[model samples]
Target: MHITLIVPTNGRPSLVSRLLAHLERQTLHPDHVIVSATTPNDIEVRPDISFKVSYVFGDPGLCAQRNRAMALCDGTTDIISFFDDDFVPCDSYLETLSRVFREHPVYAVVTGDLLADGAQGPGLGFDEAVAMLDAYRPSSLPAHVRDHPGAYGCNMSIRAQVIGDLRFDERLPLYGWQEDIDFTSQLRAHGRIVNIGQLWGVHLGAKGGRVNGVRLGYSQIVNPIYLIGKGTMQRWFGIRLICRNLVANTLKSLRPEPYIDRRGRLKGNMIGFAHVLTRRADPEHILKL
Candidate 1:
């Protein structure tokens, strides 16, 4: 299969370099690997290998970068897979991924286990962590939950046709959160998205909420609003739905796990509330990509 792997990173040159090394060793090498970098210097490694790899310079926003990366794959590419800068694909990652996509002919999008690599491996498991956003697990409720499709941009694959000119919704770019949720939701609107049973992408880094604490919180709280405005919230969140999610997240936050910090989330919820009440109509204050 003519597969194109898309990676978008802002300033993590080292991670991208390591990922390129891992890609060089992949048993089934990608036909192409497209990277959207904040600057040209982000891609420091180019292994002497047979697989096609391309790099493009872009500004620092998750969805926008991803959009630029996808542009590299026009109509000819079979599957466009996305990985975060920190991900290191397992040996059989691409090989098994191909099998998953071919196995599920009715599904336009295919995603699988995103195991954490190094010290940041997902202790909660991919299913639990992926559930934090929105996704389709075969054993769960259903393959496609609603007309909206949800996917994990970090390790997700979509058939080019199912998603026409769709790009990451740039408006909710705060801390790069919720963009994938919105993207996946949109995909689900057209066709089903399936989760591969064993395909895995190892994420190498933990949540970098330490750098932009307030903004990280802001993105967390406000992304749902932007998502809802786009009609991608699954219509499952009215006042009651919002309350449920907030309470659930709040409870999850109190766990004090350094990985998922709840203190920033509480502060972010406050900022989010302020924006939702007094700043929703304002352009600068509210989250917009």
Candidate 2:
């Protein structure tokens, strides 16, 4: 199977370059890699890489950049994989994915198990991520696959047949919070969305390039509601999501963590609630904040 790796990145040229170097070590190398970014400076050009690497430009939103990369996949590409710039996959990551897709024809989308995710807490360093990957024994664990409602954005792949004209919704904007779930969940109608344990990776979640706390917080509240209304997200799930974020932010703001802007996020959540109450909440409004 010809797999194309699409990495959508912004404001992290060096990080993306590091990810490319790691990809070179993949047991089953990708047929092509398309790095999508907002501007030329967002990525450093690499002329010495052995594998095929293509760079594309687009608007500054995550969904927009991903859409730009997806446009580059041609007929020869059998699978399209999306990886965040900070994610580090085990050496056999791509190889295992190829095997799974080749053996099972039922799955349309696949997401890997994350050994560690720094996005939930303080970001992890590149060296730390490499150490974690080095410690992992790919052959030690038994392969496991199970049905999933959605795919995580950091390390997910979709069969080309299922992606036929489908695209990430650009309305989410900026960080495109929950855009992964919105995109992969819809593919369930075409085939199964499953999690493959052998396709594991580490998410460094480096904080260098991230949306501001206010914008991100607004997204935490508004994006779920917007997606629910659009029929892309479950109503109960969306409501619980909003409530969880709101409660967490509100309580954490009292003794905010040094790494997070809890107060600002709380303020944004309040703003989102106000807008929602007035029936004027829009995911695009985060751009104005």
Residue-by-residue lDDT tens digits, candidate 2, 69-111? 9888999998999999999999998998999899989989999
Q: Name the TM-score of candidate 1.
A: 0.78
lDDT of each: 0.66, 0.91
Clashes in each model (backbone N, CA, C under 3 Å)?
A: 12, 0
How far off is residue 187 in model 1, in Å?
A: 1.7
Winner by TM-score:
2
Worst 10 residues of 1 by lDDT: 140-149
Which stretches of candidate 1 lie above 4 Å from their native place?
117-149, 207-211, 237-262, 279-289
The model with the greatest lDDT is: 2
Report the Cα lDDT for candidate 2: 0.91
Candidate 2 has its poorest 10 consecutive residues by lDDT at 136-145
Return the clash pairs for model 2, or none.
none
